[model samples]
Target: MISAKHKLLLGVAMASLLIACSPADTPAAGGRPAPAVKVSTLATEVVQKRVQALGTLLAQESIDISSNVTEKITALHFDDGDSVTKGQLLVTLQQDEEAAQLSSARADLAEQERELARLEGLLASQSAAQTEYDQRQTAKLRAQSKIAEIQALLAERTIRAPFSGVIGLRQLSPGALVSPGTSITTLDDLSVMRLDFQLPSLSIKAIAPGQRIVAHSDALNDDFDATISAVASRVNPIDRSITARALIKNPDQKLKPGMLMLVSITTSEYDAIMAPESALQSVQLQHYLWIMNADQKAERRQVELGIRKPGFVEIRSGVSVGEQLIYEGFASLQAGSTVAPQEG
Candidate 1:
C-alpha cells in the first residue's frame, strides 16, 4: 500500500476520471453563442375588416308580365328580348269583338244624347209629360254607363309595357290561347344591379348603408364595385344571419340579373399591430408569439387572435407597438433564451 510507483499510477487514474465526469460547456446555459433569429418591430397600420359571402344579383326592377283575361293572343307587338319603353304596346289579345262592342256602345250613347235633348225641349214647351222626360233622361244616362264599361273591358284586352325595360323571351306567341294570369314574359330594368347576401348577425353593429362593397362573378373575369344599400333589421332565427343588399351600377349593361357573385363588404377599417403569420406559435390550444426584450432575451407571450390576412395576423392584445419579436427560428426558443436578431 505504500509503494511510490503504485501510488502515482492511482493518482493519474483518479485525475482522468474527474476530467471525464465534469460537465462540458453548454451553448444553452451561457458559454456558447446564442441562437440566431430574425426580429421585427411591431408597427401600426390600417387594416380593413371585411366579410365575404356568395350573393345573387337582381334586377333593379323585375316582374312577370301577364294578362288579365283568358283569350287567344292576336299579335305580339314586341319581339322577344326587345327593349321597350313605358306605355309601349307589348301584346294584343282577341280584342276585335271587344272593339266592335265598344263602337256600338258609343253609337248608342250618341243616339241617346240626341233623344235626351229632344225630351228636354218637349218638357220645357209642355209638349211632353215631366215623367216621360225624366224616363228618357235616365235611359240616356244608362247608355253612357254602358260605353264606360265597354271601354274598360277593351283596355284589359291590350297589354302594354308598364315600365321601360328589356323584355325576356316571350312565352306566349300569336294565336296561343293564354289564360288569365298566364306568364307572358319577364320585364327587367337592368340599368342597375342589386346584390343580396347574408352576413353573420354579429356584424350588425359594424355594417351600415353607404359602405363600400366589391363583387366578382365566375361568369365575369373582372371585379366590380358596389355600395351597401340596405341591411336587414331582423336576424334570421335559424341561421343567425342578417340579409344585406348592395347596389351596383350597370350602366354599360355588363351585369345581368340572377347572376352569382362573390361579395365582399368592407365593414370597418382601423390601425392595428400585425405580425408575420410565421412568428405565431400554438401551445396547449392557446396562441403565443416569441418576443425579444430590452435585454435580448426571448419571451413567450400569449396573444388574442383577430382577423388574419395573407402573410400576417392581427394581434388584438398582449403585444405592444414598437416591441420587437423574433420572426424566424422561434420554434426552438424558450423563455429567457438568448437571441441574436438578424436584419431584414
Candidate 2:
C-alpha cells in the first residue's frame, strides 16, 4: 500500500496536523509589576477644641415707653432716636381740666380753713355746739384730701423717662388721642450689648461664667471679644440645648439690637495626637486611615476621633504619633500593598 509518491504526500499531511495540535512557546510566569503609588504623611500636633454658634445682639436694658393716663397728647419733648436722661420729660398730656380741678380743690380748702378759724372762735365763746364744731373740722379735712387727689391726677398727665437710654421715634404727635398703656416709644441702653444663644446640653459642663468668647457679625465686618455672663438653670427638653448669655462692651455703640452674630467658645484643651483633616478616610459607617509600616507596606487602620478644628482633628485612639499616614492615593492601594511615602 505504500508507493514512494503516496507515502511522501501522507507524511506531509501528518506533519501539518502535529503542528496545529502542539502548544507554542510563551513568556515567563512572572514579571515586574506596576509602579508603587506615592502618598503624603502627616505629623501629630496638640490642638484645642472649640464650639461655635449663632447668636443675637441685644441691648442690656430695653423698655417700651407708654402712657398710664388716657388723654390727648399735648406735647412731645423728645424726638425719635434721641438720647434721654433719667426723669426727663418725654410726653405731656392736656392738663387744663386737671389744673382746674386742682384750683377748685385749693379754693374749697381755703374756705374750710376760714370756717375752721371762725368755729374755733365760737367754741372759745361757748356759742357753737361741740358736735357742730367736730363736723366742720371733718369738712376741712375732706377738702384737703380732695386737693391731694387732684395733685396726683396732674402728675399722671405727664410721662417721664424711667432710665437713661436712647428713645425710639415718637408714636403719637401733638393732638393725638392716647389711652392708658399706649406705647409712646422704645428706650434702649446701647452702651453695652449682650449676645444670647443656645448651646448643646452636652457642653453645659464645659462652659462657665467669665469664659472668653469670640463673636463675629455680618453687619460688622470685624470680630469682637465677649465674656460669658450667664447660663441657664435648666436644659430645654424640646431642643436639648441650654441658654447662654455673653456681654460685649459697646462703648462706641456700633452694635445694635437684632444683629446676628457668630459666637466661638473654647470648650476643651488637650495634649494628644492630631492630624490634618485630609488624612482621615471613611468606609461604610466606620472611619479609617492608611498607616505605612516599617516595611513600607500600607496597613488599613480604624480610628477613634475627637473634636475637629480648622484644619486638624484630634486622634483619640488608633494610630500613634510619628507614624507615616497615607493622606492621598488610597483608591489604588489595599492592605499589605507597597507604597512610596512622600513628605508633607
Number of clashes recorded per candidate? 0, 1
Q: Candidates' TM-scores? A: 0.76, 0.70
lDDT of 2 by residue, 1-344 (tens): 69999999999999998786554421211233422544544555556678888999999999887777778988999987899999999888999988998999999889888888898899999998888888888988999899899988888888888888899877878999898778888999998898999999988877799999999987778899999999989899999999999999998889999999999887776688777677778777788888888888888889988877788777788888777877777666778766666554
The weakest ten consecutive residues by lDDT in model 2 span 25-34
CA lDDT, candidate 1, residue 146: 88
The sequence of per-residue lDDT tens digits that candidate 1 reaches over residues 1-344 is: 57999999999999998786554544556456789998988999999988789999999999998889888888988877888999999888888887888888888878878887887888788888988777877887888898889888888888898888899998877999988778999999989899999988987876689988799988988899999999988999999999999999998888999899998777778999988888889877899999999999999999998989999999999889999988899888889988888887
lDDT of each model, Cα atoms only?
0.88, 0.83
TM-score of model 2 (CA atoms): 0.70
Best by lDDT: 1
- The residue pairs found clashing in candidate 1 are none
